[model samples]
Target: MKKLTLPATVPVKELAERLSVSGPELIKYLMGNGVMASLNQSVDFDTAALAADHFGFEAESEEAVAEAAPASTRRRHPLLDQSRADPKSLVARPPVVTVLGHVDHGKTSLLDAIRETAVASGEAGGITQKIGAYQVEKSGRKITFIDTPGHEAFTAMRARGADVTDIAVLVVAADDGVMPQTEEAIQHVRSAEVPIIVALNKIDKDGANPDRILQQLADRGLVSSDYGGDVTVVRTSAKTGEGVTDLLDMILLTADAEVEPKADPKVGAVGTVIESHRDPGRGPVATVLVQNGTLRVGDYIVAGQVYGRIRALLDERGERMQQAAPSTPAVVTGLSGVAEAGDVFQVMANERSARSLAEERGFAAKQQQAQPVRRITLADLASQVAEGSVKSLNVIVKAEANGSLEALRGQIEKIEDPNVKVVIVASGVGPVGEADVNLAAVTDSIVIGFNVRPDDRAKAAADTQGVDVRYYDVIYQIADDIAKAIKGLYEPTFVDVFQGRAEVRQVFTVDGRPAIAGSHVIDGRIPRNSICTVLRDGKQIARSRVAVLKRFKDDVREVARGYDCGITLEDFGDFAVGDVLEAYTVEQQNL
Candidate 1:
């Protein structure tokens, strides 16, 4: 059978030509299959596929074709987009790796086994609370590992900047196999275009089958080297340390050859703040991963608008250190204020220079704050497309729970627009805040809050930074708004106004087509030409416009409370006694 590839939506005539069939023949085929479409009209992927099946051809969409390609042929991931350092001053540095996988897939357990620490007990729910960076010595060579929260919501923070991970160590359970978060992590790692090493964890568990897990990985396009693919798969038991040593060996081997994680240590210190917070005793503290050069005590550094001299540097063990080399994580205490989690920290020549640069940045921030918030509207999307300023709509979503956030993210991801990609930058459980607004402003993203409200400070920051913060109580509304905005397909938004209701007293047929619902206006008033809804036992069953209204054989425009009226529902005849006839008007508003 012939194979045909089509877009998400294809015009009828275009599809006909591709199938070597006439437009009328295609339309007839659709009609035979209970689908109606004109030659110039469009049909969705499902419709096209159905018609193609009838025509003896296998159909696939462009997205499906792209997704079917080997993982090695995929484009470099956006998270791994790090600029190279000066080769003249470059020295071999430990490869910074990140462990990402599905929740409860033993990501933390694997880390604990590697670090030989009990950090999991400190977390609230056995899940990693925040991003943690650690360096381990293997065979006298160091390897930096960034332990990201395995939950799906934390994926947003991983996409902020590149050079974050030189290699991604995907942890998959030997029995449980690849999951939703695993797919999410794969998308991120692919965007970074970094080498991957699979840790088939939980080999000690009952029913564990490493081969089955490898097959699942292969289905996801990650073929292992044991099967002739370049990707390495290491079977490991985080509890028993079985194959754990080999995993480390593979990491070091991959880093030495495939990743070559090196930086210029002789230059000024430049690194990213993996996490930051306020310490009651120390005032402020930032956990930073030095990507280039060296971070030392007494060196004045500027991060965002916060600037200060590094008074002390502490390693992952909380011990004071004098300096942190490239790929090393350090807890620095000396920032003037709390910096952002993803902010880049760079050492300046002196405290004076640092302060000067910070003042300038602070002024710029104030100016941004003075501007009006940038709302994502259809007109804005049109302008952006016209100017070629954007090809994707980057969004950060915050919700009240992980389930809601995940559901919202899934729906948002499915809003297909061939012109613009909908990129959910990050999603987590919480009210929207200043941190969200700050990230949105820097990345030209919008903040979407589901069943959550932003605090006063977050609102103020959003207003100042001109960041768009939209909140929604309904999940479908969020999807609808984004679809309209990105596709330039705005419809009249309707607000239902309660114009009173009538309880059905009896039902009479009119010409066996229209049903007359004899009802009494129990409250308020029921006006003519209003949209009517049939409520059966407090549940709405159908909605239609009021076609006819009468009071004792006199045509009336409305019936007030305590009065009886005869109402004929338009295109609806199903009426039962004890049913309610609700009348309301649709209030349309502009987008």
Candidate 2:
């Protein structure tokens, strides 16, 4: 029997048409193996290999098939080598660019002007609301623009050390020269190390001053092209469309100087998510940029924890696109859950395989959590190291607000010793409580509390359980003490004894469980089962039992100054994130 042959590349729509299946139907089939794609998106040869397997065919390589097939059969697959064609030779390849600037700096207006211009020239109007990537042709050259909101989202990717941008267009309003966000954008672009073209926007406004903007740019080390500097700065009014073409021309020149890599459709697909969000209509929607491989409809994909077949692929203009390759960003529908923004995505073989890989990853995460962490104090660290115990300093940070929490966390993470590292077991914005104490107790870690205190019952519980609950209003003190602890230079200063002044930070309500109060060590280490008193407004509120003591959600022996713990009250309750927990121990003076 003569063997039936398939083309290496087929139009995404044509495949569905030939198979009498909808675009989404073909996409679902492709996605079974972990290639997230949509109907309009094109699938390459390797992807077709999987699709052919689904159809019960022994998939053959494109080269092998080409050698076996007659010339008449080869012409049917026109989309196969389009992406592999020379990037410079192909006028169809759109230049992907991102616009970045400060808030209210006409960043949106510039994009609006571009959209308006394209529409006025007979392009579609529905493209404006799409995520910043879109195709616009200027002087018959295709250009793709990514309209990022500000440096926050721009740098957010860099925080993960991923550079997904090809070119960065720094939008600086002529009237607003060198704002904080502008400097931030400059820093982000520099950090990203991508080529940047400056847009001196809103030039038609009354307050416009291009010269001042240029001077400000010089202050930030950005020397403009017109001033013998390498940076290209274009002054334009988005309202009047003046200098827009000049800006586009400069971008084209920049792109011409830098060659973009073309992908081999025969290889497996690897991509990155430009954006992702949860939608009511769709479970998880992600905007993906195919950097080096071909993505087709129905390709199964793995992005972070989510795994699903490509249900749909929407372009920046909300139009269904057949295929996306290098520099092509498309909105993909069909993920198990919302993947984090900037997560790397790749195509897999089948739905079952993709699900298996995802499940394996999930199990691995659980296994990681189950793995034991070594805790070495300053006194025991050297001996432990000699005994082959190398571990990080496990910590639980409790703060009053998000900013302080983040700031302190960043500073603590900046402590760069390999032997001594800081691992935040759990952190939240609230008062230290019983849960914190219990966690610390188990992990043998200290919980640091900032601008918050613990309650009466929590203090007694911490005292009874010997869990540490440390409080600090100043951030440097916390960092310094942690450093000292890591270095074994931590001294029990400030009375080397318990006077019992402490505070509360938070209270946690575990479902179907009793309430746990989060508290801090205000003054002196609250020793286990020490005599304690509960004072509210300098008066005895109630005397209760010390029910539990926890550190980093783990049971621990004790906690010292500048630490936090979780504690349960014996009888009294009513506690919150910023209440004080005072503890006391009788000082025995031997003569």
Candidate 3:
């Protein structure tokens, strides 16, 4: 038998020809596996493997095809090629700092205060929203600030292996003390191995206690230098601009005392995508922060799968610039599409080289999508727990309204399992869709929808990608489900709640045994095999299990309220005309 050559995905007809089988036969084989593919329809590796086994042929993924080719054919991204740089040309660059904290903790306000101070000092670039980034001048030096929404965006950018930031400024509200998101931000900063400069904000508010905030920081492993630790804590109020200058001074001092932010500005520009969006006038715009070299006008850059020339370079002031140096944030126009946030951007030799690299990486990404995915299930949580792989249960929540989503998020995050942390990857209002499933798959998170339903496409993708999609009408139910999952062994118990009462009109004998009681359902429907209690004038006579419930001569599952039906109970013989039959059902609720 000849070995079948498969490119990540292969058409049914093409595989059939390689296997010497008829196309219809291959399609029938695929149909047995639940993949209804036509002759020309492409099948992923799983489908291809099954077809190849049935037809006595060998199939390999596209990665094997690349391995069979010459080593020179495989292209490495230029940004990863460290040998291309010259150590002699390296120079000190501004430290790229990310301000992370809980929402409304003065993260944006501190950035604004720094920008205003820099602008007052005759800095060329004013604050620009295009890149969500800016640079502030301090002591004849520059410190770049990436104004992300929160710590999640900061971690998401780092998750893509784009280590762009040199330091993290952790902002904490003095009045609020240490919040849940504050701890999360601290973890992200520590995980990234970036030094943190604590910015204690909101000191102007009533009941503000900087000392209390410092004590809380001690509990989280962040001791202040005043307390005989290396961490620097600067108390600042962004609203009044008090101690804001001191905060900037501390950032510069920390950068010098700790790690020196240096880059080779003599080489081609290499950086990361801070933010990206589509503009009405421009085709695709990206807010890129150049980490190394100098990005100039007309430079061809490839960011992840998107490649384009620098049609225009706009500084943080929204004014056109000729070039941007290391740690400089610039809005570049003319990308083929909006590159993903956190995608690494590099300047190639020419447009053709950039295009070729993008195409190569794009193809490789598609091939990775074709590989088999091991779907994580509730049962697998045990194995993950044993392997210590499940330290946290990451969740993406979708809801019908912002208020409900926030409520659900707040309650779910409170599900405390010291062994397993619960992290909310993303949350929004609306029906759960494919985008949510994609994010969950990428982050190894589960999609949780509260008072919302997943569309058919999202459901299918979740199943295919092995992402768990759970729907709940009540907020507490979702919380309980996740709590049980993290605990790994907590089984729930249920109690039977009475549904309704019915009166027996008459009784009939079947095969010489007390069989059916002809009754009228007084309230609520009576379900089949539900527990019933025989009562005589509000006094309990006996309790029996419902054997069968029938409406008329037909065997029906349920008898609705205000309807006549026959009910049969096991191990019960006595029947009375005035007897009442009460029905109840048991439902399991997680504790």
Q: Give one digit per residue, the lDDT tens place, for model 3 in 1-591.
A: 224456678777556544444455677778888898876479887778778877665566657755765533112223432322355767888988889998878888878777777652376344445468877787789888888887767765665657677789999999988886787677557656679999999899998999999999997789999899889999999999998899888888888889787777776788889889898988798998898779999998888889989999987778899999998989999889889998988886677667766775676578768886566655466457656778877888888997998899899878897788888866777898765676665567777888899889888877677787777888987887777778775354568788888999998887997767899999987888898999998998888888988878888888888999999898786878979999988754322
Best by lDDT: 3
lDDT of 1 by residue, 1-591 (tens): 445677899988667645544466788889988888986689999999988888766687778765875433222222121232235666798888889888788988888787753231232234322337877767878888886664222334543332467888999999899875686577556655688899999999998988888888897789999999888999999999888789889999998888787777776677878888998999899888898778899999877679999999987766678999889888898899998766767777677667766665676678767775555444466467556665888788889998998899899999887778888765667888665675665556778889999999888877666676878899998898878767655443568889989999988986666788999999889999999999987899999999989998999999999999999878788899999988998854322
TM-score of each: 0.55, 0.52, 0.55
Q: Model 3, stretches more than 4 Å misplaced?
A: 1-86, 120-130, 374-591
- Model 2 RMSD in Å is 16.6
Q: How do these models rank on lDDT, best leading?
A: 3, 1, 2
Flag the better candidate by lDDT, 2 or 3. Answer: 3
Q: List the residue pairs that clash in candidate 1.
A: 76-191, 77-191, 77-192, 77-193, 78-191, 156-425, 156-426, 369-464
Q: Per-model C-alpha lDDT, please? A: 0.76, 0.66, 0.78
**Collision count of model 3:** 0
